[model samples]
Target: MKPLKIAMMSMTHGHTRKYYQTLKDNPKLDWVAVSTANDEVKEIFLNSVDGIPCYNSELEMLDAHPEIEAVVLASENSEHLRQMKLCAERGIHILSMKIPTFDMDEYEEMIDIVDKNDLVCQVELEMHYNPVIVRMKELLANNEIGKIKSFNATNITLSPVWAFPWQGVPEKSYGKRVHVKEGDPRFRGGALCDHPHIFDMIRHMTGSDFDCIYAEVAPNIRPDIIEEDMLSVIGRMKDGTIFSLDPSWSKMEERLKVPGPGWEVFPKRMEVNITLNGEKGTVMADCFGPNVYHNGCPNDRYTVQYTYFDEWIGLIDEFVDNIRNKKQPLINLKWHKRTIEAMNAVYESIATGKVVKL
Candidate 1:
């Protein structure tokens, strides 16, 4: 079989570096060019890694590697549409960031572009590939939860905007700034904008759409931001399963650019703990760990050092397989719309101060 050639664009994202080892190590993929959003991010990429040529611009990189078949849009969430369109027009398949364009109309346009080009557009929700989550999925599907009547999930983490500046920007992260409610100091973007995983995961687990969603915010822990840092959403699934999800930036982190030992001030820097209450029993899961403890170099605080944390490996494998074999990706456009819809409901709920039907 021919190897699938893939490139990565906009190396400014927090997950950008995480993909490096996975891309190079994947046997089926020929990792190619990398383009940064600007000269600054380009210089940072230049200084950090090896075995990959980092280009200052996409056109320059694509001009060099015309054989490139796919690209990972590892840019800020705001850059997704423009970057994907560039790849789509070139007949290159895309692996997009977690949050695509918040505008439903633009998202629909993305589907149309892929349809017109017969291209793959897979949104990266990496938790789907986690081993623990995979096991959790299997057990839940095997009636371990005994009919999910409700789901409560948390995709809580520190605000990465300190390192990835775009996330803190209302215009870039949220696409637009709208108030959550009257007299609300916080804007509609921020942490809520950062997380759509649990929202999407609930859809995946139950195979049901959200019936309604309501959201409320608490004052941000950090000052000088138009976006929210704390919030919660409660809703009902299409199957009448009541659910609640907290995708807040509730955890505290040491201000670090390159993630390291002391990065997390909290015990867990990131978490995707799920709680499923069913007719017969309940299932609680932590996709990241049951990790071993550590207090060695970098930071002296005892930490639940994670044993397995790479989700990009499996995600890239699937991307390669879909490209080489001409199969649809698991997180394709049509499948992700409802997740976006559910997220929009949170914005709508905060807007109207009432439950938004999904």
Candidate 2:
């Protein structure tokens, strides 16, 4: 298959740094250009960047690299729509960050634009590609554990505000400034917006749709932001599988600009641990754990060093296959709508203090 001529937009996202190696090393992609949100981000992007041409404006980058076939929209939440429109207008395929947009109408517009352009639009929920998760899916499909009565998943991670400040802003991170309730100062976009993998995963695991969602917020670890740093949601899938999710920025951090070592005040920067209760048996898995440990460096504390990082390889490979072979990706826009809808239901549940129906 021919390699995809790819580009990345907005270097300010938390996942921007993670994609650098994947974009450059993947045999299926040719990372052609990058456009940052501002001069500060541009300087940060260029200072350590290797060969890719870093542009100050998307127009300039697109004009210079007209052959660029695909793009990874690594922008802030609010910038997704504008950047997506630009990519769609150019007929470029997209790999959007997890939360595309909170507004349903705007989200629908994005879908329409991409479909009209006949482009592949895949969302980034890297947990879908994790090997441990791949194993879990295989096990569940095989019914190694009988009917799942309840599932609990935790996607807790250190706050990215220090690294990606835009995430801490209500308007920038949540797509708008939304009051959760009459007296609640914290807006709708916060830790919940940052973590949607568990929500999305439940749908995949149970092969069901969202039924209703109930959410509650906790006291913020960092009180400076308008977004909540902690949240919990309990819901039932249409298939009758009950689930609970803890999508909080509960881990501690050292305020590093880039996501790297010594970046976490806690030993592990992130955790995606899950537990399931079933009729036949039960299982617990840590998708990103049981990893290599290290006690070296700036902090001599023992750390679970990550060894597996091929999610982008699988994701990009799928995109390439979709383009080259004319097959739809597993996480395409159409397939991901339910996940987005489920996420929205959580917010609605929070606002009304009642279970939101799908």
Candidate 3:
């Protein structure tokens, strides 16, 4: 298959840095151009060694690189719809960030635009490509643990607000400035918006849609931020599997503009640990752990240096395969709509202080 000409827009997302190397190295993608949100982002991107052309406007980038067949919409949660519409207008395929938009109407509009343009729109739920999660899915499918009775998952991480401040803003992160509750000091966007993998992954594990969900928010760990940083969700799947999720920014990190060693004040900067109890037995897994430990010059603090990083490789591969072979991706917009609905239900449950039925 020919390498699909690709570009990236809005270098303001937390996942922007993670995709540079993979985009450049992937055989199926021809990393061509990038457009930044502003001069600050442009300067930062230009300083990088990738040497890709940077444009100040999406139109300019798209016009200059007319050969570009696809784009990675690496923008904030609010910017997804506009950027996606631009790509759709140009008849280009898209690989959007995880939280496309909190507004269901906009999400459906995006689906309509993509369908009208006949383009491949793949959401970046990269956990689907994680090897450990892959193994977990296999085990569950094999019924090695029998019918799943209950499971708990933690998608905890240190807040990236220092590097990506948009994450701290309610409108940009959650797509609106709705209050969490009447007297609550914080707004709707925070750790919950940043972490959606566990919510999306549970569906693949149980082969079920959300039945009902109950959620609660704890006080913020970083009190300076105006969004909720700690929260939990307990829900049941339609298939009778009950699950709990801790998708909080509980881990602490130094306010580093760029992530590197010494950024973590905690032993592990990020963790995704899952535990399951089934009728026959129980299983435990770490999606991004059990790696080599190091305490070196950067911070002199012990840290877990990650060993696996090919999730994006597989994700991009699937995107290209879907485009080239004319097959729908596993996590297409229609399939992901339910995950977004479930997440919205979490916020609704928090606001109403009652279980939300799906």
Candidate 4:
């Protein structure tokens, strides 16, 4: 297949930096121009990348590079719908960040817009493409652990709010500024908004939708930010599999303006580990692990230097195939709606202080 001409918009997402290498290295994609949220972000992007045109606005970038066929919407959660609408209007294929929108009606509008444009809008759920996750799925399919009785997973990471300020804003991260619950000072957006992979992963593992979810919010680790940084969720799946998930920003950081070597105060920084309790046996897997360790350079603290895998390569490959072959992606807007719904239910459960039935 011919390389798809692709550009990235709003270089503000935490995952935006992760895509730089993939966009440049992937033979299936022609890395084109980029549009940043502002001059500051543009400078940040330009400092690292070379020989690529950077613009202040999407329209300016699009006008200059009309040949651009697809875009990676690496913006805040609130910016997704507007950006999606703009892309849809131009009939451009989209690779949206994980949380498209928190509002269900807006999400439905996104689905309609994409459908109407006959465009491939693939959500970036990179965990689906992780090698460890692929192998885990294979084990589950082969019944290596027999029938799953309980699914427990942790998607914990250091907060990116220091580097990406939008994540710390309630309206920007959660698509609204509503309080998390009655009398709670913190708002709806935080770690839960950042981590949706475990919620989506359980569905693929168990072939079940969320039955009910109970969630509780802990005091903010970064009390300066109005968004909740720590939370826990326990839920059940439609297939009778119970689950406990921790998608918290429990790991501490150095409050760096730009993410780099010394960003982590915690050694591992990020972890997505899964444990399955089955009738026959139990299985434990670490999604991003088996790494090299070092306590040198910027910080003398011991840190897990990750031997990063190219999950984005597989993800972009599927996006390209979906566009070229006119086929739907595995993690398309329609297929991912339930996952989004489940995430919203987590917020509802937190607000009501009761189990939310799905």
Candidate 5:
């Protein structure tokens, strides 16, 4: 099997660090060059001692490493279209970060570009690779819970503003500076924008699309932040299943320049748990839990040491297969478009204080 030559661009996303080790160690990928043009990101890559070359300009990197077949666009949401266009123009496959673009037209443009080039464009919604989620889907499919009547899910986490300030910037994170509410200082980008896993995951589990959605925002946990840190969404699926989701950055964190020890003020910095009530029984799951706990560290605070950080491994494995085998990824652009639409509906609901019909 030929290993896919992969590069990363724009190391400004929260998931940027999560892919470093996987990219380096994965057998199916040759983690080549990284281009950011950000001094801080370059310095961080230099300090990692991974020996992977870094370039200040993406064009320079591509010029030097013409063999690169794919790239992970680990940049802010606003840059997705531009970066994707560069990759598409080069006939390079792309592993896009979640929330490709809040603008539907731009999202459709991405689909067209990738389709025209016949390139494999996979969105990085890695939760589908989670072991727990895999089992959850199995149970749901097998009718272990009969029929899913309703579900409540949480894709909550601590804010990543200190580490990646782009998340707090409305224009960068949400691709616009539109206010979330008329009288509110908060903008469209925030916790809701940061967490799209639940919204995407529910669709896969139920094999249904959103029908209608109603969303509301609460006072942000951290008033200092410019975006909304807290919000909730209630909606109905096309299959008549009711759903409620909390995709908020409700957890608090210490302002850390780089995400590492002493960052999380809460015992659990991130969580993606779900409870589904079906006709026969109820199912509850923690997609990233049952981990080892420790307190003797840089912070001397209790923390969850995850047993598995292999979501990226599986994701990349599929990505490499898609490239090598000429197969479309399960979360291709067309399939993920509806997921993006559902998320946008949540924002529209908040702005209008009315239920949005998808």
Candidate 6:
């Protein structure tokens, strides 16, 4: 297979840094230039990576590297539509961040752009590519756990606001500053916006669409931020599988400008754990665990040094395959539409304090 020449844009998302090593090392890719959100982001990118030229704007990077075939849209949620439009206009394939936009209209516009351009746009739900998840899917396919009756998952992480300030802004993270509920100071974008994996994952596991959802938000751990920091969701799938999900920033972290050692105040900085009760048996899986631990660092605090399974490898590989083979990704815009709708319904449930039927 011919290697795809790729670049990255708006190096501002929390997951942007995670892609550096994968882009560099992937033999299927020819890692090209990048466009940063600002000079500070450029400096940070320069400090961490070398050789790849960084541009001040997306147009400048694209203009300079006209051979680029694809890009990783590692940008704020608000910037997704604009960036997608730019890339689609250029006939460039895109690997978009998790939450493309909370607004359904803009989401439809994004779909239109990709469909019209004949582009391969993959949503980055990296959990789908994790080895544990792959195994879990296999076991379910083999009926090792029989018919799934209940599904529970947690996609918890320390708040990334300190490292990526836009995450704390409701307008940027959620694409608007709508209140999460009437008379609530908190806005609609927070932990829920950051963690869409479980929302998407449950659908894949149950082979069912969402039937109804109920959600509630707890008091923010960091009340200074207008967006929510902690929340829980419970719902039933169309196939009658009951599910409870916690996609909260319940894990605490140090207020670091850059993510690095000692950033985690909690021993484990992030977790994606799943538990399923089936007709025959039960299965529990930790998607990100059994990691190495340490008490030596800048702060000497015990922390989890995540030895991740590098989900990006498979993710990027699939993106490349989709673009090269004229095939749709597993998490394409159309297939992921219901997942996004389900997430939007979660916020609606939080707002009304009632179960939302989807």
lDDT of model 4, residue 139: 92
Q: lDDT tens digits, residues 266-322, model 4?
A: 898999999999998999999998999999989899999899768998998899999
Error of 5 at 99 (Å): 1.2
Residue pairs with backbone overlap in model 4: none
lDDT of 4: 0.93
**Where is model 3 more than 4 Å wrong at Cα?**
none
Span of 10 residues, lowest total lDDT, candidate 1? 295-304
Per-prediction TM-score to the true structure, in the order listed: 0.96, 0.96, 0.98, 0.99, 0.98, 0.99
Candidate 6 lDDT over 1-358, as tens digits, reads: 8899999999999999889989999999999899999988889999999999999999999999999999999999999999999998899999999998889999899999999999999999999889999999999999998999999999999999999999998899988888999999889889999999998999999999999999999999988889999999998999999999999999999999999888889988999999999999999999987899889968888888888869998999899999999999999988888988999999999999999999
TM-score of 3: 0.98
TM-score of model 4 vs. true structure: 0.99
In candidate 5, residue 75 scores what lDDT? 94
lDDT of 1 by residue, 90-169 (tens): 99999998888888888998999999999988889898999877887898889976889999999999888778888888
The number of residue pairs in model 6 that clash at the backbone is 0
lDDT of 3 at 51: 72
**Global lDDT of model 1:** 0.85
Which residue ranges in model 6 land beyond 4 Å of their true spot?
none
Candidate with better TM-score, 1 vs 5: 5
Q: RMSD, model 4, all Cα superposed?
A: 0.9
> What lDDT, from 0 to 1, does candidate 6 have?
0.93
